[model samples]
Target: MPEPITQTEYWNGDVGARWAAMQAELDQVFAPLTAALLDGAGLRPGERVLDIGCGCGETALLAAARTGPGGTVTAVDVSRPMLERARARPAGGSPIAWIEADAQTHPFAPEHDVALSRFGVMFFEESRTAFANVRRALRPGGRLVVLCWRALAENAWVHVPRDAVLTVLPEPAPSPPGGPGPFRFADGEALVDLLGQAGFTGAAVAPIDHPVAIGADAEAAARFAATVGPIAGLLREIEDPALRERALAAMRQAMPAERPVRLGAACWLATAVHPG
Candidate 1:
């Protein structure tokens, strides 16, 4: 496995476990983005699909449904714990093959007609190499449709909570500008450049802005902010109980009064074709 050790350790450990536990909540919150990605995939009744970074398998299951019984979907991710959760879900007649492997170097069969991901392609240690590998997994003229964050500044769901936490604790050192993280592909041109370098042709990146559900209520949203995603990771680093509680309170205070608080988020819906 040539994956970055830090990412592997983080996802396969407590973070992954936490995500698995909160899979339902996470899925519901990000349902719109998932829908958008699937909508753009243009899946047919019998087209083979490859789902990268399949998390808890929501996207894979949905893709399977579109592919119908005659088609197949191969869903891959690095987190075994997540894969366990995915496997535990009812299949609902979707033919999905869940594999716990790093997509960057995994020996995928070269048969898929489409490759799809939702916020999954950003974490590759080497974007070009990983995408090249993805391209190789597809038959000629296969399509790639992915959804990735546009920019941290444009995503209130992410930056707002982290900012709240930072009021109580020092901001952690930033990762490399285009490093392996959620915001790695935030720049649309950079993403297009990466795909082009990876042997993909006619790469197009478009903005997909939507309102994402945070929680059923403000309180629940606050709790989610403190217990999941990047803010949660930051909270773990704060050893002082008093400080952590203060940070949590700050985040909680920032949530809106609306039920299922809808926050604006921006992502790039990138599309490309594998050249013949």
Candidate 2:
């Protein structure tokens, strides 16, 4: 039997704090992506939506707006810090519920018309079971749409920090495969397979491009990429302070020296519907 993959403690520890801070600072960068995600989900009036892995409720809040006065939106995440920040968003008169819970195990009410995630749903240790649980939360014909990185080759969220990670850290300090981590769904074929295995039928994977404004300047952007991304965790694992400092320096240099620096992000819109 294989050992089950689990969430990294680093995400909830000091790393999570820095990640939260970075999220707050770059909240604007995520807004347009969230809008695009929900819009693609074909949001409608009086619909009940679930925002899975909804880091800070960005998509959930948008769902609330799309659903108008009579609809409800629920956003869930495992990160308490993320949820706290999400709760602090200025309340609108629409119904939006925020919960801190693991998506893999949380019970769903089977009343939702749609489920969505933006740059979320990529960290499941066991995607088959995790998605099965998500499938259970929806009505017979309920649908799901998510924004996940298409591959490491295409997204700076990986490549930028990866460039710094390889330089700063020694070779082959490899984290375990099948371990609970982000971008696990980066493989388009595998993601579809998992959804099919989870009882979802007729899925489509679509390419999505959005402008990501990393920071106002190169420095803030560098810090943001270094602290909250996949590369940052690897960088943090290094033992030498000198190497760490060098990594940060390289990240700063890697960033373009421009005001309101914009980077194009590539993601996949994986959408599916439940068979009635």
Top-lDDT candidate index: 1
Candidate 2 similarity to native, TM-score: 0.90
Tell me the number of clashing residue pairs for each predicted model: 1, 0
Local distance difference test, each candidate: 0.88, 0.77
Local accuracy of candidate 2 as per-residue lDDT tens digits, 155-218: 7745775776567666556567655556666678888888999999998788887768878887
Summing lDDT over every window of 10 consecutive residues in candidate 1, give the lowest-scoring window.
Answer: 1-10
Per-candidate TM-score against the hidden true structure: 0.96, 0.90
Residue 18 error, candidate 2, Å: 2.4
Model 1 residue pairs with clashes: 216-260
In model 2, the runs with Cα more than 4 Å from the true position are 1-5, 8-10, 238-240
Query: By summed lDDT, which 10 consecutive residues of candidate 2 come out lowest?
Result: 3-12
